[model samples]
Target: MTTHNTAEMRICDAIWSIGVMLDYTQKIAGFVTPELLDWRPEFPAGDFAFSLGEQLMHITDIRMWIVSQLGTEKHAYERWAGPYPGIDQPWTFRAGSHSEVMEALESSRQLVQPWIERPMGELSLPTAGTVAAWEKALAAMREKGEDTSQLEAKGAGTLGSALFFLLAHENGHRTVTQTMLRMAGAPVERLA
Candidate 1:
């Protein structure tokens, strides 16, 4: 019997959780028919919305960012585009067919594998870019005089937290995508 180091176990758990979330996302995405891929909720003009395919693409985009930003690969860092501005800003991502979106997710996993397989000192360091983005995201909530202390604490700032953030972020969008699929008459189960 082997005894496990707590830090190692925590890191393993974090990686495992990310993997499980990715698998669940893939399974749910599998149910998205081509017909439902472009469907989005009927929001008012100027309101924010994402088509089903865009949602999947968005998930892959953030995952790629995390790996590129925090990973050990010099090439990935060199090729990394700057951080995304905001949700309201125009997205450069062009949503493709179901197979293409699935391929994107799979490639994101491959890109992240080598980074996560090795331990890095930066894993525990605060992720300044992500923290700044969180502050921007919380601006509206703060304006409403709402208590956002808890959320601020949970914001992703470390490489480890950023990995978990991928799950939380994707899971939130997956709900919207799954709902749109259901409305489009596709059978999207509650896989998560």
Candidate 2:
């Protein structure tokens, strides 16, 4: 029997985490009916207490947000085309129906699929030409004396951390969703 190196083990763990998240997503999707989509706890906490549909949509929203940051060419904010629930604005994408919400969830999965499929060995290495392109852009910004603070604040952009972020983020949403379902009286069974 062969033992894997630390990097290989880490990647395998990340893959396992992703699989667990997928299972949670599918289980939640299975029990959420169309009527329950708009259900929310009567005790309100403003937007913090999102409806069942928003809670589900938020899972996809945040998933895409994190995945978009992993790209070499564009930032997450730059690539965000859907409703952005910024400080003042509200999210506009309606979880119109059960099927629509599922479709959005599918789109989110697709965004992260490439990273999941990447070889563990290749993930540690920079993509060919990507580093050069990034350097060139950074050099131009520095030469122009432009502020790079926003650019710097984007997380490490490493595959490991990004995968971890996806898992952690989805886990939070999963908890919220399950709680929301329970409050709405449609709680799904916990995975065995």
Candidate 3:
């Protein structure tokens, strides 16, 4: 297998693992009563502000955004669209259910998997329409002397960056979701 294929496989495994972890976390979250959505912990005392529903939806959005960036010249640091709603924001139109989130994630994974397997040369960084807008945004960031080397080093301008960001972001939220489950009096398992 080529290096690109190897990297894609690793990313695929990571994505699958994150999906499983989200599934398990959602199962535990389901046990929490609706009345406890606003519950907060006593010791260490941090607000468990976002609900389980919100977290799942946030994960779905993150997946979509990452998948959309793949195979495009659009840098991940660039802001393409308006204030996209994330976990902390109100999901006005977006589905916030566990099933809905899973579906979105699965669909995005299906779309992105093929692109991930392609060799680096096969990838094209086209700057057109939304991608062009993204490039403009990135240029502004560069003008400010922002060090985007970390992003570039991790294949930020390609599909690999999408996978890397998704994995890292999911891991961070998984930790938060587990904490929320534990606070809700549900049996939590350490994500392996």
Candidate 4:
């Protein structure tokens, strides 16, 4: 049987510690215009690509996925399969108006709060079926030259890696969204 590690919780706490995600979500609200929310940064084809809008969608979907994956209760492999809702749904994501995306993003961030607070040090990540998913997330960070040594050291098959990946996934997009907004000459001021 696997055990939740107190050390792992400390690491994750620093990642999304109390009020950190809440502050993030609140600050992001009303910071960008509906048009600016639709903005995308200039990047090579397939290179860290995501418009501000797409980033928001990706954040929302991934937040839910991480919460599901990292929940204290273990679930069947089959229960995890299927196309995630709101993913790539431009009508509700990219093409949707700014308010739509903001609403979804805010709700998703809120959904992630309890999971972030829950202790996950003891729970182990499912090794076989889901290892590839987190491996991809870690690979994305590595491609950007981020020091994933600690995360990599976890061997890509533990809850430790999974928690860190979620933090990376959500935090990466949030940072990118802000940068993209700035690049468009929008104020970086906290709006909420």
Candidate 5:
């Protein structure tokens, strides 16, 4: 294979690993109780900042947003459309319980899987032109007081940056969700 194809396969392999990580984290997060998902600690203590429910929803949103950028030049965030929660202020997208959140997360996760294997989700978008997509997503993110420049910096305007952001982001949240899971009185190590 050519260098480009090799790189693509490498990226796909890394992303497929991300799928494994997501499954692990989501399984732990599934233990959160409805009340725990809504419960917030008094202070930000290592991943305890947002209610467990909110954080799960946010992860789902990030997955969806990444898919949106690659799927189209027409981002799904312009007016903050429905069906999926828009990354706007307060993140008012509500999930009735952990099940609801996991359902949405799984749905979005499936959507993004194709993105890792295919060329930018096979939407025929420009490569390296992904910088524009990230910029638009960041602008909308800023309106909601989120800053992702650090992530953009890492990617140097390539889609890999976005892919890495999603993988790392989900991996990072695992600990937080597990902590919440334990706090909610679920066993830390789940059994088969």
Candidate 6:
């Protein structure tokens, strides 16, 4: 009989969490509008300098970061540029239209889905710098008699933690966007 390890279970849980978040985000995106993007809600005034569209881009950026970390290959971090500080800044992208934002989210999911579905054995633990650096770290850890099994456990912990952070970060932005919609006198329950 084939048995699953703790690491494999954690990876599966992470994938499931991300799937739920993606569905939620996709639904929220349907309610967003160019005008809603422009409105700045006053309840929490002078908080964010960027527009709603920019915040959505930031959410995508965070998602891409998680995606890049799932693999060990070079060019794993590559993603389409958005209107943020740089390609890395998913928060500042200028998504002027609802269609554009939806497309961007869809594109991000497409890039991430394969990685999410990949087996835990095929996925690499987070390593520092280049592959050479990672190898050196592994050697050092081994010399210190660090429990490699525990290291796998720690990595499993990371998968769930990363998913939680990603979901929370996206939901924070979604709250702001929904607030803006309410301020614009548009129905907000449709998003929830």
Best by lDDT: 1
Q: How much is 59 displaced in model 1, in angstroms?
A: 0.6
Expressed as tens digits, the lDDT of each residue in 68-186 for candidate 6 is: 55445544333433444653432334334666666766777676666556456543544232344445566788999886765544443233345566678887877766666666677
For residues 111-190, write the lDDT of model 2, one tens digit per residue.
77767766676555544333444566677888999977765554234666666777887888888888778777785667
- Stretches off by above 4 angstroms in model 2 are 5-15, 44-48, 72-92, 122-156
Model 6 segments beyond 4 Å from truth? 1-17, 42-49, 72-98, 119-158, 190-192
| lDDT of candidate 1 over 1-192, digit per residue (tens) | 977654554443545666676677777778777777777777667665667777778777777877755643543322122346586775444537688777776778677665455454556866556566667668978999888888788775677677667778888977777787887788776766
Candidate no. 4 TM-score: 0.55
lDDT of 4 by residue, 61-179 (tens): 67666656555444222221134445543233334667767776677666656645555553354534256656777889989988888877756455556556776666666777777
Residue pairs that clash (backbone atoms under 3 angstroms), model 3: none
Best by TM-score: 2
Candidate 4 at residue 138, lDDT?
Answer: 87
RMSD of 1: 8.0
Task: Give the better candidate number (3 or 4) by TM-score.
Answer: 4
- The positional error of residue 124 in candidate 1, measured at the CA in angstroms, is 2.7
TM-score comparison, 1 vs 5, better candidate: 1
lDDT of candidate model 2 versus the reference? 0.66
- RMSD to the native, candidate 4? 10.4
- By lDDT, rank the candidates, best first: 1, 2, 5, 4, 6, 3
Worst 10 residues of 2 by lDDT: 72-81
Clashing pairs in 5: none
Arranged by TM-score with the best first, the candidates are 2, 1, 5, 6, 4, 3
Candidate 2 residue 59 C-alpha distance from true site, Å: 1.2
List residue ranges in candidate 4 displaced over 4 A: 1-22, 42-49, 72-94, 120-159, 189-192
Who is ahead in TM-score, 2 or 4? Answer: 2
TM-score of each: 0.65, 0.70, 0.51, 0.55, 0.61, 0.58
